[model samples]
Each structure stands twice: as C-alpha cells, then as structure tokens.
Target: MKDELLIKFLLKETNAREDSEVTEWLAAGAANQRYFSQMELIWNVSKQLAVTSTVDEDAAWNKFKENAGQLDVQRPRVRMFPGKFLKAAAALLLALGAWSAYILLRPGYTTIESAATVRTEILPDGSEITLNKNASLSYQTRFSGNRRNIKLNKGEVFFKVAPDRKKPFVIASGNTTVTVVGTSFNVKYRNDQTEVIVETGIVKVRNGDNEVLLHAGERALAGKGINLAAQKNPDQLYQFYRSRVFIAHNTPLSRIVEVLNENYDARIRVADPEKAALEITTTLNDENLDHILEILALTLKLTVVKEGDEIILK
Candidate 1:
C-alpha cells in the first residue's frame, strides 16, 4: 500500500474504496497489520508533537537508527517489502524517537496563570483546581511515578482533589506544603505568607519544621514569626471567587471590606475604627460595585462617602 493511502486510512480521511483496499491489505497478513499499527502510532505522536514543538526529523531518524541497532538482536522477523515501505517505517521510528525525546526534554512543570478573572483547571488525575485572579499554579504535564504534585506559585487556589491514597496530592505554596489524600481546600500565598483553609476532608500544612493537620471548617497560617497552627475558619469569604457570593457569618466590617477590595478592585474602608469592629451577617451575591456597597451601607446603617478614589463608610 502507498504511504499516502495508508496515512489517509490511519487518519480516517480515506473514501469508501480506499478504506476497503486498506482493510483488505491488513487482512492479507500479520506483517501488514503490524505495519499499519506502526504508522498509526507515528501519525498520532507526530500530530501531538506538532502542536507542542518543532521536530528535528534528521535527529529523530538518527536516534531511531541507534535504538533500532540495539534491538535488532531481539527483533521479530518479518517479510521485507518495497523501499517505500521501508522509508515509511523509518518515518514511523523517527516519530517514536521524537516523542521520546520530547518527553525527556520538556520542562518539568506546566505553569498556568490567571490574569484578571478566576480560572479553573482539571488535572490528569481528575483533581480540579480553581485559581483566583492573578494566581499562578504549576504541575507536571503527566503525573508519572508516585505522587501528584502541584505548586501554587502565587495568589489563591482552591483544590478539589481526587482520592488516591497510594499517591497523595501535594501542593507547594511558598515555604509551606499541603498534603492530602482526597480533600477540598484553599491555599493562598501572598505577602510572603501561606494560608490554608480546609472546606472538606483533611489537609496537612507544613512550614519549615512545623506542621499542622486541618479538618473541614479549619484553617492554618504560616509565615515569618507566625506559629503554624490550625484554627477555626472565620468565614466563607475565601470561596467568593469560586461561588460568586460573598458570605459573611457575623464577619467584621474591616474583614469584609478587605475581601471586597480584593474581589471587586474597589477601595472600600471603614472610616471609624469602632465601626470597623462592627459585625454583619449577610450574603452578598456578585453584583455591581455600587450595588454591593449600597447593601453594605444599609446593613451597617452607615453612610458611604466617596473621598477621592476611595470609598469610606462610617
């Protein structure tokens, strides 16, 4: 069979007559079937490599020849075909070599960044991660070997990890490391500090020599001059990016304003220090900045004033 016809058949682009011809050719002998299988593998691998990086065909051929020489002693005997078939087989071996080289030379981590809005990623092991705005995360493209490891380069990220006790899901955020078998949690790395909040299942946060295990509804803070310890999660504000709702359960005005500024890019502050301590329990759905501010003002019975570029409440 011609290489073009075989390639078209491999790609499923062949017409009915061509398909019949290729099917009949494969049925003729095991060697023909093996040749077609080799071509199919080469086509798939080359297509994948084409998207990622440029392939050096000459180098790949050379690598394939070198490896083929080593395997010749153990290689199975097959009837030889025309020079064109040999050339096609060489191309197949070349692609296989290129794929191997690509895997070996590729960077260890595939980094992902969120610019102005939240981003979601599903990992190879079925773990899901939601990155907050300006957040960065990195992980191996293929989860090989034992562990499923990830790095929270900066900003906040929530993880809903798939269960795999044998291969634990681990994340590195700044100096802290979080380890879990199957769990959902949030990790925020900002201002040289790493904070972890567990929403479901159990999470282990480690900083330097100190480590703390946190359960659902618990959190931990790790940074310079900070003791690593699990504490009760204050509010559901951490999930605002994912849920699109700012939930305050008797949350302080100061804390609420801080999150609002982070989420909406709004400069909101409590003018009176006493008012900053005032607590409010409310769920603010994602809406316009002005509308959210209006709700906050009404709930706190405070006046909202626009002074320069800042919004102040008293």
Candidate 2:
C-alpha cells in the first residue's frame, strides 16, 4: 500500500488504545517522530481547508463554484490523476456538500443532547461514554490534539476514557476543565454550576481563570471560578454511580417504570392492576434489557420476550 493509504487507515482507526503504540513508534527513532510530525502538520492544514463549511443555501452554491474554479490545474499523467484518486476526491466533495446542507436545514442538530439518562456515545477516538440520568454531553468532530475533547452541554457524564497519555482526557463544562491522564471520572455541570468528582485515579479541574490540580476523592465546582475542595464524604465517594443499580426504593410505580426504562434500556409499563398496585423494590446492577425484564417479570409476575434490544411487556 502507498504511504498515504497507510496513514489514512491509521487515521481512521485512531483510538485511545492506539495512542500507546503510536507514542512508542514515535519514540522508536527520530525519523519515525519526524514522519509523524509531518503527518500531523498535513492533517491540521487539511482540516482548516473547511471543505464542508456552512453558509446560506443561495450563497453556498456560488461559493462552491468559486471554490471549484480556484482549484489548481490537474496534470494529465495517470499517476497524478489516477481513477481511484478522482473517485476519492469526488466522494469527499459530495460528503462535504451533504454535511453543509444538513447543518443548514436542521438547526436542532446544532444542539447537543439535553437531559438524557444513560446515554451511550461513541467518541471520535472510538471510546464509549455513558452519561447518567439528567445528564448532558456534546462534542465537535474537529478538535485539537493533546487530548480527547468533549463539551458537557449540561448534566453529568461517566467517562471510561480510552488510554491516551499523548492526548490527555479533558471534559469542559461551564468554567471547569476536568483533566486526567487516563482514568474514569464523573462530571456534572447543569444550570450555571459544575461538579466534577473523580472515581479512580485523579483529575484536575481548571476554570476559565483558575487551574488547580485535583486528586482522587476530590470534587470541584466551577462557577465564576473553580472552587475545589477535598470530598467531604470520601468513604462513599461514588456510591450513587458505582452501585449502577437502578433501585426504585419505595418510588412510585409510574416513576419507577420511567426510571427503569431510562436506565436499563427497558420500555416496561404497569400493564395489570396487580402490577400497578404493587410497589416493588429491585436492583439493576448493570443488567441488560432482557435481564432487567426477567427480574421485573419475576418480581411483578409479568411476561417478557426476546424481541431484539426492545422489551415489550404486558
């Protein structure tokens, strides 16, 4: 394969796990490091080209025409104008146009998620994130390196950051910047306030004007400036999240069903009079839809099925 194709494959497959190998490869020798540096420069310049820049619908077509005319002259040589190269360039341009149209027509997508519970998100680095109830998070596909980047729209997020020391794990919400080498942490930034409490290892929370190093068992609240103090309850530091069990302890049936549905990915409702009247208490410790439904069935004596991920109860 060509050098460009190798780099493209690596770029597409880039993730936190690959970071270690890349770092090691970079440090293998000065030549390898130089190659990476050049590639990064190219990547940076390519991104700034803004092939998918958004503009008014009428203005966009005019701009595209102008942009196309401004392109450099293409050589007739097959090597310079290969069939594969033309196809790839055409595909890339089409994708860019589609992206611009999507941004122009759908303004709501300009919004990140809001007030979500147990949101499973895939990051640009292929790392998965799960935001808990009343949680919110957002991100831009384009971001600076040196870390995985995310903007917490609102609410809280539990991060299982893929390990990438070169690019530190960073969460920005309000004025707080939760920075970690490579670890798990929960950040809650709703309303105008921000809360960050680390679970494992350590994370540093820095506000717009304040950057303070925070250790494990440390929580930070950022508003106006970063206010970080040692966690008052160090013993049960992360009990609420660590339990991972959606326990509707004496909670109303209607509310409990909603919580269960949101958390365990179930769509169960009180189907019968007996089930509705029964105020059952159960724990869902990382239970899937089927497992949770089965437990609920045993608890409430209801029927469940294996209709893919969806749980339809009666």
Per-residue lDDT, model 2, residue 190, is 66
What is candidate 2's lDDT per residue for 1-314, written digit by digit as tens?
Answer: 12343244345644565556566776777655554554455344435544543434334434434443322222234443334433433343354664442232221212346354456676766666776766666664533334456778876577777777777767778766787767777777767787777667778887776766656667667787435555532333233444665665554455555656645546566656565656666655666656766776787677865456555555
lDDT of 1 at 284: 68
| Model 1 ranges off by over 4 Å | 1-107
lDDT per residue as tens, model 1, 48-135:
4454443444454566645433111222123323333334544555655545633433325679999998999998899999999999
Q: Per-model C-alpha lDDT, please?
A: 0.78, 0.56
- The positional error of residue 163 in candidate 2, measured at the CA in angstroms, is 1.5
Worst 10 residues of 2 by lDDT: 101-110
Look at candidate 1 and tell me the lDDT of residue 279: 93
- List the candidates' TM-scores in order: 0.66, 0.42
Q: Considering every candidate listed, which one attains the maximal lDDT? A: 1
- Which stretch of 10 consecutive residues in model 1 shows the poorest summed lDDT? 69-78
* RMSD vs true structure, all candidates: 10.8, 15.0
Question: Evaluated with TM-score, which candidate comes out highest?
Answer: 1
